[model samples]
Target: MQNQSLTIKKEKILTGDRATGQLHLGHFVGSLQQRTALQHQYEQTILVADLQGLTDNGHNPHKVSSNILNVVADYLAVGIDPQKTTICLQSAIPALSELTMYYSNLVSVARLQRNPTVKNEIAGKSFGSSIPTGFLTYPISQAADITAFKATLIPVGDDQLPMIEQTNEIVRKLNYIAQDDILVECRPLLSKVSRLPSSDGKSKMSKSMGNCILLDSSERDISKAVKSMYTDPSHLRVEDPGKVEGNVVFTYLDAFHPDAAYVHELKARYQQGGLGDGTTKKILEECLQEILKPIRERRKTFISDKSQLIEILRSGSQKSQEESNQVLNSVKNAFGLNFFQL
Candidate 1:
C-alpha cells in the first residue's frame, strides 16, 4: 500500500494545534492522521500555535512554552514527517501578528460578536459577556494564520466549520475592500470520524477532564484507562445484554479500529448478551496499543533529541517567515500601505 501510487491535484494546507497540552487519541484521529496522509500530496504547514495559545493562556506563558515541545512531540509521534511538512512555531512569525492587527480594523466588534464560532466558544468556556478581547477575536487571528501562508485547505473537525466560513468571509471582505484577492480563502477538510467520546462518557475529551488517553501513556496505563472506560451502565452482568449507544468503547472502535467485520461481530455479541464489558475493553486496549506503540516509541526518540527538535522548529520558522513576508507584502501593496517614504 505504501508503494502504490495515486495521482491527484494538490493544494496547500495549513492545520495545527494550540500548544495547550499534550495531545491525545482524539487529536490523532481527528486531525493528525489526515495531516500525515496529506503531507506528501500537498504543500503543508503544521503550526504549533503558541501565539494563539496566548489568547487564553496569557497568564501562563510557561504553560504554553512547556507545551510547545510537548505538542511538537505529539506531531512527531503521530508521523507528521517534518521533511515533508513545514513545522512552524506561530509566534516566531512576526508578520502574522502584524497582519492580524490590520485585519482587526477591517472587522467590527459587532461583526466579531456575530461570529458563530466565537459565540459558541465563548459560551462553552462560560466567558459570557466578558470574553477576553484576544479570545473574542481569535477567528481573525486564525484568518491571519491561514492567509499568512495562503493556505487553501484547512482540515478541521465538524464543529469548526464555522471557522472556515469566518475565514472566507474575511477573505472576501479583504479582497473587496483592497480590490485584490491578496488573502486566499480556505475550505474545510472534515474528518470521517465522529467526535471522540471521553473515557468517562463525558461530552468532550479535554485535558482538564482527566478522561483523555495521552499519546505517551504506558501499556499499563492504557490498560487501566480502558478498564475504567465508560460503557453501558445497565451492562452490570456479562449476560445482561448491553447497549452500544453512547458507549465509549464502541465509539472508540468505530473511530480507530480498522477491522469493521470483527467490530460488528463484537457489538452484536455484546448487545445479544454473553460478551463482557471487560472482554470488550481488553479488545480496545489491544487495538489501541497496536496504533499507539509505534507513536510512543517515535515520541521517545523525539524527546531524547530535544535540541535537534528545537533546531527543526527554528529552520521551519525561518522558512515560514519567508512565505509570510511575501503574503504580507502583497496585502500591504493591495491596500496601498507599502510605500516606505509616505
Candidate 2:
C-alpha cells in the first residue's frame, strides 16, 4: 500500500487565466507574481483556460485560440518556470471536461444563479435576461478543474471567493452521496493586492477597454499608458494641491513601487501642492518600465521560438492528464460508473 503520510505532506496548487488576452500588470499584482513565488513550494499547475474563455467568447473562437500562445508567452516571460510549474491547456485535458459534465449534475440552476461572482459578471457584460448557459455554469467547470487535480490550494482574487465556496459545496455533496472521499475541497489564497484598476482609472483593467499595460508592452507603450493614467481631475496646476484618493497613478505606485518612503514622500508632496502630474506620471512611468523591461526581453526570446512553446504546453498537458485521470477513475469507481477498469 502507498504511504499515506507521504501523500499528506504534498501540497498541490491549481490556478490560471482565461485565454482571451495577454496578461497585464493587474495580473502580475493580482496573482502571477504570487504563483511564481509559490511554484517551488507546491506542486503547481497553471491552466490556460481556453474552455472558460469560450464561455463568453463562443462566437469569436479565433480570439481565444489566437491568444493561447500569447498567454503562455506572458507566463514564461513573467518567470513562471516551465521546469517548476506545469502549464497546461484546459481543453487539452479531456478528463476535466468529463468531470465537469458529472459535477454539473450535482449542482442546481438556482444555486449557480445565486453565485455572486457569476451574477456580477453577467450584469457587467449586460447579458441581463439573456445569459449564456455556459457562462452561467462556468463555476461548475471551474470546480471540475480544481477537483480533477485534487488541488489543496487555489490562488484567486477576493471576487472569486464565491466560486471557491461553490466548488467546496459540490465536493461535499458528491462525497456525501457516494459515501466516499473521492474529491477534495480547495482553499482560496486571496491575493494580497486585491485588484488593479485600469490606467484610465476604471474599476478593473480590461484588454477590451484598451486601458491595460500588457506584460509584454514595449517601453513606449508603457510610457503612453502611464502618461494617460488618471490623476486628481481638479488639480490643473503644478502648485495646486491634488487629491490622492481615487488617483490611479498613486494606486499603481503603492502596488509596484519598491521604495515605500519615496512613494510616501511623493504622496505628501502632491497633497501639499508642489508636485505636478507630469512629474508624478514620469515617476510612475519609470517605475513601470523598470519592472517590465526584463519581462519584455524574456518574452521576446520565447515568442521567437513557437515550436518550443508548443512542446512545453504539450508536455505539461500530458502530465496534467495523467494526474487528473487517476482522480476521475476514483470518482467513477465511487459512483459505480467504472464499467471497464483498465
Candidate 3:
C-alpha cells in the first residue's frame, strides 16, 4: 500500500483508447473510473489514439476519424474533468511521430513479429502476408508515445502487459545506445476487473461486434442488451441449479453492482437454485441503467457543442506538445540529431 501511494504521488499516468468507437461499460470498469479517481492524484494524460486506430481500419479511415469527438465525450461523461486531466489527440502530436520514426530503427521486424500481443492481433485480423508495416510495429509507436511524455504508469488490460513490456525494452535499448537515460520506462496498471467479455460470450466487449452496451446507449438499448446476455444454457428452469462462474449477468453484477454483499447473496442463490435468469438479468439491467443514465446525459451535453469539444482537444494537445518536445529534444541530443538551435 505504501508502494502504491508512492507510485501514485510520483508517477505520471498515460492511458487512452483507439478512436474507433464510443466507449462502453467494459471500459468504464476497466479504466475510465480509475482515470477520474486518479486525475487529481497524478498528472494524467488521455490520448485519443487516432493514428493507432488507423492501423487496422486504414481501409475505413472515416471510422477512425469520425469517432474522435465521441470518444472524448465518453471521457468527459465518465467524470474525467478536462481541468484535471490533459486530454490530447495523438495525430496532433508531431513530436510523437518524429520519435516513432527514430525509435523504429531500434526495433527489429523479427522482434516486432515476436511480440505476443502483435502476434495475437495478427492472428485475429488474418492479415496474412499483407500486414501493414504500421500495424506490425505498433509497439514502437506506443513506445514513442510513452517515452515522449515521460509517463511512468500506463493503465491497460492484462492482454496489454506485453505492450508495456516491449515499451520498457525500447526504453532500455534506447538509453543503452545513446549512453544516456533519454527515456523513462513505464509500468502497466491493470484494473482489478481486467476484462469484460461480450454480452453474447463471444469475445472481449468490442464496439465493432455490436454486442457491447455502450456508455451512451439509450434506455431501450440497455434493456435489449441485458435481456440478450448469455447465461447458463442448461438452467432451463428457475429451480435448476445455475453456474455463476461464467454467467454474464452475474459477471456484470460483480463489476458494476455497488453492493458486494448483495451481489454475493444473489450469486449464492443463483448457484443453489430458484434464481431465474430473468431475475438476475433484471437486477443487472436496473444497476446498469442507474449507473449509465447520468453518463449518457453528460455525454450528450458534451457532444452537443462540437466546437467546444475541438477547442478542449486543441488546448490539451498544445500542452502535450510542450512537454513532449522537451523529451524529444533530449532524445535527439542523445542521438546527435539536434543540429539547429531553432
Candidate closer to the true structure by lDDT (higher is better), 1 or 2: 2
Give the C-alpha miss distance for residue 271 in model 3, angstroms.
1.0
Q: Mind sharing the TM-score for model 1?
A: 0.94
Worst 10 residues of 2 by lDDT: 202-211
RMSD for each model, in Å, please?
3.2, 2.5, 3.2
Q: List the candidate 2 regions with Cα displacement exceeding 4 Å.
A: 1-8
Worst 10 residues of 3 by lDDT: 1-10
In candidate 2, what are the lDDT values of residues 85-203, reduced to their tens digit? 99999999999999888888888899998999998998889987878889999999999999999998999999999999999999998899789888889999999887899987866
Candidates 1 and 3 compared: the better one by TM-score is 3
Candidate 1 collision pairs = none
Segments in model 3 whose C-alpha atoms lie over 4 Å from true places: 1-10
lDDT of each: 0.88, 0.92, 0.92
Q: For model 1, what is the error of residue 295's alpha carbon versus the real structure, in angstroms, after optimal superposition?
A: 1.4
Clash counts for all predictions: 0, 0, 0
Model 2's TM-score against the true structure:
0.95
Between prediction 1 and prediction 2, which has the larger TM-score? 2
